[model samples]
Every structure is written in structure tokens, then in C-alpha cells.
Target chain A: MLKIEGLRVELPGFALQDIHLEIANGDYFVLVGPSASGKTVLLETIAGMHRVSTGHIWLDQRDITGLEPERRQLGMVYQDCALFPHLSVAENIAFGLKVRGRPPSDIARQQERLVRLLDIGPLLARRTTRLSGGERQKVALARALMTDPEVLLLDEPLGALDPQTRENVREEIIKLHTELGLTIIHVTHDFEEAVAMGQNIAVIGAGAIRQVGPADEIFRHPDSEFVARFTMAVNVFPGRTEVGPAGTSTFVVADARLLTRSTVEGPCWAAIRPDSIQLVATSSEAGPDNRFTGQISRIINKGSVVEVTVDLPPAMTCLLTRHGFDQLDLAVGRPVCLVVPPAAVHLFQD
Target chain B: MSKHPGSQLRGKSRGGGQSLNWVFTLLGMLILLFILVPLFKMVFLSNKQALGQALLDPQTLSSIGLTIYAALIATAIGFVLGVPLAYLFARREFPGKGILEGLIDLPIVVPHSAAGIALLFVFGSNFLVGRGFKAVGIQFIDSLAGIVIAMLFVSVPILITSAKESFRKVDVRLEKVARTLGASPWQAFARVTFPLAWRSILAGSLMMWARGMSEFGAVIILAYHPTVAPILVYQRFETYGLAQAIPVAAIMIMISALVFIGVQTLLRRRDAGA
Candidate 1:
């Protein structure tokens, strides 16, 4: 496990205020945020690139904060796949293992396993400059894993790949992570990538993480408006909260009302995942369980899904599937009910 | 207007006629003529008899031989020392990097005669360095070694500059990767960076050697007795007039140009093969 504490950085206006996190062995932890959110900076710091102003990093219980990147037994893959162009693919793949002073036979054994795992056997003898993006990324991953590092830090390893190639290489990275059971702290601005790739996602903002939880939970239960917006939580409705059951609160959306399971209220904000909202026609609008009424504002065709933006009362939008939109067959000016099940409602303190 | 697409495209480049292009072609010819005229005069005027007579004279032949030998020695010394300095300038950052690089380049801006006067102050037989060296049986004043030192003093900056540019073009990631691959810093540099920059270094060395060979003022002031080819050419003109000087100048230019073209061709062929 790797742990970081008090990762405070004094930037011009913001500080990375006391960042504390832990990654257990075999954990695929991802740092997700938009550009300039300090995700890359934090990852690079963890990778032994930048000097932490005030912090201690522990790798498997050893204080490695002062160790050089090469000595830390940590492997890093950059977005650009910084492969040594002067070396052949075989030599590149064997780089870290050689650095560890392994015997020739032992190096060969590790090289063979990586070659098969990444399926780069034939391309091993070729110069690195000739490798395509996917091919180069594969070699870079293999090289990183050759040392059998305690943890692998990937800085948007697929940032340079095409869509299809990104999917393939991402799968390769995950498969290696599974096979080696390596600890990972990957960073990316790609929302779907984070969801698909990481088990535990930290929603970072400005320079600090607003919330850290299981990817699905953070998506369903964001703790702040910043986290809400960053996680692609599309429907943010400003509202006022009133005290209710035990610690629970009732939120008053504009021209509409909804109740969350938690209550800390003055001026409160509520977010609903687009997929969390169920669209129903006027006949089914008679239910009273957290419902809003509005017209089908627009229909946007998202591949295999249609994004339905509804100007419902209380004013909100949600993403429903093409099949869901097709069967509803509701046109503009057509009235419908927006249903956000209370369990799916994420509440944030004002 | 005819709607032929290709013809309209051609018309835009040439205004549908060749008049403007002809002017451009003539302008290019004039530019070439401006450069080639001086080069043409420098060659083709030297004759075998005059050159033979110059080479036969002991003073003239000895000076030409010493000039060639000293330039070679100085170029060799620069190759050994300048390459590392070039690499350091290109790769490493330190305090006073700009000033150090500028100081290395100072010789290029200083006049050759001024360079001779400066060297005389430091390495003269009566000066501290020259006196110390003389005590050790090594003398700088009026010696072939002094001429070689003067040549190196003046021309090494060019070698360092060209070599630094070459080393900069080489991706530093290659060195980093080599280090991660278990090669030591020296091994990585020797195995990779040196080979890649070798061509540029070679080209730079040739240019420096050519420059050093043509040096007159500094060598003449420091060690005029062991006259180099340029000084010999000068001495011949003083005693026997331009008739003697022109042939030696032509012969020196011929030999230097041949060497320059040969090395350049080799560089081009290697690049093309790669």
C-alpha cells in the first residue's frame, strides 16, 4: 500500500490542502477531474517527480518520499509513452528489469511473460520510433511492469490513442493490473474511462479531492457541487432545504419539491444522474413520489442512447436511452413526468 | 472565363504567363553570380610552374607543411575537448551557463591580430605561462606548437557551437532510457549520443581545420619563422611579387576546397543512407 499525508502545496491562489489518501495492494485507484484540477500534479508528486512542500509518502510501510523515482520501485507511464527511440522494443521492454541488476536468464523470463501478455512478441526487434500509438503504449506498459514495482502510476496512458485503440490499450492495462495484482493510481479527465477503469475514484477539484468513494457511489452520491459537476452529474438544481425526519432534510426545487435522505439546510443544491431519472408519459404522471412535470425540451442522439433534455417544472434535465425515448415517442410540447427516485438523489450541504 | 480548374490553378501561380517567373529566374541567376564571381577568381588563376616553384622553395614548402600539420593537431585537440564541452552546454544547466558559453565564443568575435597580441601577453617566452613552460623545456614563442595553439585558440569555438547544435538535436530521452536500461552515464553517452553527433562533429572539425589552416595574423605574430601556408603565400608575394603569391593561394584554396567537398559528400551520403 502507498499512503500520502498532508500534501499541501502553496500555489499562487490555491493550496492542495492536506491531501491524504491510501491505495491498498491490488487496488485500482483513479484520480478523476477536469483539466488543471491538480490531478496530474498530484499523480506526478506521488510518482516522485515533484518535491512535496509538506508531506510524507509511504510505500509498503517504508518512507520513500525522498527516494529517487528510479529507486522508489515505482513505475510510471506518461501520456506520451516516453519510450527510448534509440532502443529496440525488446531492449525497451527489458529496461527496468536490467536496471534492477537481474541476471540475463531472469530478465529473459520476465520479458517473455510480458511479451505474451501484451502480445508484442513480433515487434520486439523493431525500433521504438516505428511503433504505432497502441504498439508503443503496450511496450511502455511492459517496460514499467518488468521491474515488478510495488505500484504503477499511469498519467493518462491512453491520452494519445484513437478511440478504438484507447479501448484496446485500456483493456490491456487492466488485464496486466489483474494478472500482476499491482497497485495503481491512474489519472484521467475521462469520466467514462474512470467509471469503466477504476474501482475507487477520487473526485478532485481545483487542487483537492472533494470526495472519494466507489466510482458508482461518487457518481450517485456526490458530496459537493464541484464534485457533482466534475463527475458529469448533469442536473444541478439550486434549492432551499427544510428540516425533516431525524437528520433528514426536504429540498424545495424551483417550482417543484423533492426530499433527500439527509438534511443540512440553508441554501442547498441537489444533483441527479441523467440515467437515474425515469421518463414517463402524461398517463403515468399521476404518481406523487418525487415527481416533476414538464415538456420534452429536445432530443439529442447519443450513440445507442438518446439524451432527453426535459424542461420540467422545478427545471431539470436527464439522460435516458434511445429505446426509452423511442417508446415514449413524446415530441416537443408533449407533457411528461420526471421521476428521480429519492434513493438516487444526492444531497449536498449549503 | 474558361472554367478549367487546373488551368485556373496554374494561372494563379504564374499569372497565366511566364513573365513574372522569368524575372524571378533572372534574379536568382544574379544572386548566384554575385557569390560565384569571387570564388571563380580565387581558383583557376594558379598555375603548376608557379606552384612548383613555390613548393620547391624550402621556406614556402616548410610553411605549407607546418600549417597543414598544426591545423590537424589543433583540430584533433579540439575534437577531444570541445565535444564534451558542447554536450555540457547542450544538456546540463548550471550557474553562469550563458556567460561560460559566451566566453568560449569570444574568440570568434575578436580580430586575429588582436588574438595574437592577447596570446602574446599570456604565453609569450617572457610571460608567466611561457616562462614556466620554457623551464619545463616546452616553448610557445616562435614554435610550430605555438602556431597550433593559436589556431586552436581561434577556431575551437566554431567546433563547440556546431557540435552543441548536433547534440541538442539528439533526443535526451535516449540517454534517460539508456540509464534506466542499466547503462552508466558514460556508457550511454559513448554508445548513443556520441555516435549520433559524430557526423556533425566531423563537419564542424573540417570547417575549423580549414579555418585554422588559413590563419595568418595570429600565427605570423606568434611564430612567423615556421610559416604556415597563408603566411608563406604572403612572404612569397613580398619577395617575388603577386606572380608568386597567386599560385600558392590557388593551390591552398584547391586543397582546402577538395577536403571540404569530400567531407561534406561523406556526411550527405551517410545521412541519405540512414
Candidate 2:
């Protein structure tokens, strides 16, 4: 288990403050945030690359806050795959073992294991400069794993690859983690990647973690407006909430009222995911709690799904499958009814 | 179709660009000729009999040997002392770093005789550093030590500047990754950073050695008794005029050119292999 308590790192113009997290052994934890949002800094700090101002990092019940990176036994793969350009692939993978002065036979054994694990045998004789982006990532991963580090930190590992290559490598990395059952902390700004890879996610913004929970919980119930928006909750509105007669909640923004389950009754921001709002023709039967009739103002075909914008006083975006969009024959300037469930609107204090 | 607008414009531009290229080629050839003419003429002026006699002359041979010996020592010293400073200049920033870097390059800009005078202040027999070394029975005046100190003082900046550039080209992230992968700081530098930068460092050292070999003014002031090749060339010119000096000058030029070409060819082959 790895635990960070009250971790504070002060950089030149930014500071990550009071970071607290506990990652269980064998758990795949992800840190997700926007660019320059301290995600990489936090990962580097965990890897013992940065100086921690006020904190204690406990690994398996031992305080390792003052340990050097080598002693900390944390492997880190950089976004650019910082492979040693002068070394061939086999030498790069065996670098850690060689530096530790392992016996030749032992080193060879470990090298064989990692080469087969990463399926990089064919690339063993090639220099790192000859590898493509995806190939470089694999070599970097093999090199990082050579030391048998307790936690592997990946900083935007798939961020440099093309879309198709990224998917392939992403699957490979997931398989590597599962097969080894190693604890990993992967950092990226892609929410879909976080949801796909992480069992638990920490949403970092500015310099602090806004929320940390299971992937679905953080996605469904973000603690702040920043978390909500960063998680691609595209429909957000500043509003006030009032307790209804039956202890229900109603959020008011501009001229539209949204039914919500939140109990806090004051100025707030109501966030709704684009996929959660359902658009139906006016002739269809609609529920009463959160039904608004609006004209379709925009239509965008996004390969798999279509994004439709509805002008209901405050504009709203809804995602629909291509088949659903074709069934409705949706077009701009057509009237549509938007159905939003009360449970779908997440409201938080401003 | 006969006169497509874009094709006509492209033809005109291409014709203009070709003329500009010819002008640039002519100017480049002129400078190349200016450098090659004197060197080639000096070699051709000396007959093989005179060149063989100069090669067999004890003084000429010993002086050439001393020049190579002193330059080698100076380059070795520069590698030992300047490489660490180069690494620091490449990686770290501290107060007065700019001033220190400027001080490293000061020898290059200062007049060589003036630099000899500056060294004499600190390293002359009666001075503090000289006195300290004298306690150990090592004299700097009119000694091999003096010759090497002068050459190193003048030529080490080339080594340090190029070494600093080499170290700066290596990504610091590679070193960080090495450290994380069970290597200590020194091990990381030795295994990763040094290997990556060594080729450039070798190239820099060769340039420094060449510069040290050609150094004359500082060595003349400090150790004229133990003559290097350059001082010998000057001395022959002074006593026996240009006729006698030309043979020794031609021999030195041939040796220097041969060494330069050999090192360049070796480096090019290594680059291609890599």
C-alpha cells in the first residue's frame, strides 16, 4: 500500500497543497486533470523526483518520504519515452539490472523475461532512435519494468501515439498491469482513458485534488464545478436551488428550471452530462419533472454519435447515436422536447 | 495552355534563383581560394630535399615532439579540470554563474602576451601560487610546466565550451530515468549522460589540442628556451630569414594537416556507423 498524507510541494509559481491519497496494493490508480494541472508534478513527487515540502509518504507501512528515487523503487515512464538513445533495445532494458550489478546470468534471465513480456525480441538489436513512437513506448515500458519497482508511474504514456496505435498500446499496458498485478499510477488529461484504465480516479485541478473516488463515482458525482466541467459535463449553468413542497429540489438558471436530487438550497451550479439529456419530438409523451421544449439550433455528426444543441433559454447540448439521430431526422431550427431525469442533474454550491 | 500563369511565374522565379545561386557559389569559391592558395603555395615552395633535411634536423624534430607533448598534456589537464565545470555550466544555475562562464572564455579574447603577463602575476617565481609550487620543487619559469600551463590557459576554453554544448544536448530526463532505475547519481552520469556526450567531447578535445599546438605568444613569453614548433619557426625566420623557415613551416603544416584529416575521417566513419 502507498499513502501520501498532507503532501505539499512548492514550486516557483505553483504549489500542490495538502495532497492526501491512499493507493492499495495491486490497484490501478489514475490522476486526471487538464494541462499544467499538477498531475505530472504529483506523479514526479511520488516517484521521488520532486522535493516534498510538508508530507510523509508511507510505502507498505514504512516512511519513504526522504528516500531517493532509486531507493524508493518507483519506476517512471516519461511522456516522451526518455529512452537512452545510445543504447540498443536489449541494453536499454537491461540497464537497471546492470547498474544494480546483478550477475550476468541473472541479468540475462530478467532481460529474457522482460523482452518476452513486452514482445520486443525483434527490436533487441536496434537502437532506440530507430523505434517508432509506439515501439519507443514499449521499449521504455520494458526498461522501467526491469527493476521490478513496486509502483510504476506512467506520465501520459499513450499521449504521443496516433489514435489506432494508442488503442493498441493502451490495451497492451492494461494487459501488462493485469498479468503482473502491479500497482500503477497513470497520469493523463484524457477522461476516457482514466475511466478505461483506472479502478479509482483522482481529479486534480490547479494544485489540489478536487475529488478522489471510484471512476464511476467521480464521474457521476463530482464535488465541485471544476471537477464537473473537467470531466466533460458540458452542460453547466449558474443557478439557485430551492426545496420544493415534497422535499424535492428544483434548480433555477436563467428561465429554465431543472429538477435535481441535491438538498442544498442556495446559489449553485447545476451540471448535466451531454449524453444524459434525451431529445424527443414534441408529439411524444414527456415526463413532467424536467421537461423543456426548445428548437434544435445545431447538429454535429461525430462519427459514432451526433451532438445536438437545443436553445432552451440557456443552450444545452445532447448526444445521440447516429441511428437515433436518423430516426428523429433531427435538423437545426426543428422543435424538440428535452427530457432530463431529476437524478441526472448534479448540483453543487458555487 | 501555352502560357499558364503559375508555370510562367515559377519559371521566372527559378531563373532568378539560379542566378542568385551562381553569385553565392562564386563568392564561396573566392573565400575558399583565399584560404587554400597560401597553404598550397607554402608547401610547394619547399623542395623535398630541404623538407627531408628539416625532418632529419634534431632541433626541428625535438621541437615538433615538444609541441605535441605539451599540447597533449594541456588537453589532458583540460579534460580533467574543465569537464566538471562544463557539466555544471550545462546543468546548474547559481549566482555569479554568468560571470564564471565569462571568465572561462576570457583567455580566448585576451591578448596571448597579456595573458602570459596575467599568468606571471600569479605563477611567477616570487608570486603566491609560484611560491607554493616552489615549496614542492616544481618551477614554472622556463620549464615544460610553464609551456603546458601557457597552452592550457589559452586553449582550455575551446574544450569547455564544446563540452558544455555536448552536455546540454543530452536530455536531463534521461538521467532522471536512470536514477529511478536503480542507478545512483554518479552511475547515471557515467552510464547515460557521459556516453551520450563523449563523441562531442572527443571532437572538442581534438580542437583544443590543435589550438594548444599552434599557441605561440604565451609560450614564447614563458618558456622560449624549450622551443615548440611554432617558436622554432619564428626563431628560424628571425635568424636565417624566410628561406630557412619555409622548410620547417612546410613540414609542420604537413604534419598538422595529416593529423586533422585523420581525426576528421575517423570521426566521420564513427558518425556513420552510429
Q: Can you tell me the DockQ of model 2?
A: 0.82
Second chain TM-score, each model: 0.88, 0.94
Alpha-carbon RMSD of each model: 4.3, 2.2
Off by over 4 Å in 2: A283-288, B1-5, B262-273
State residue A218's C-alpha deviation in candidate 2, in Å.
Answer: 1.5
Q: Clashes in model 2: which pairs?
A: none
lDDT against true structure, model 1: 0.81
Query: Per-residue CA lDDT of candidate 1, range A1-350, in tens?
Result: 88888787665555676888988889999999888888877876776655678988998899977765666777777787778655689987887666567899999998999899889999999998788999999988888888877888888988889999998998898898888888888999988899899999997888987788898888777888888887888888777887764666677876676767655577878888888888888646534477777888887788888877777565567776777777878787778888888776777863
CAPRI tier of model 2: high
The candidate maximizing TM-score is: 2
DockQ of each: 0.28, 0.82
Q: Looking at model 2 chain A, which ten-residue stretch has the lowest summed lDDT? A: A280-289
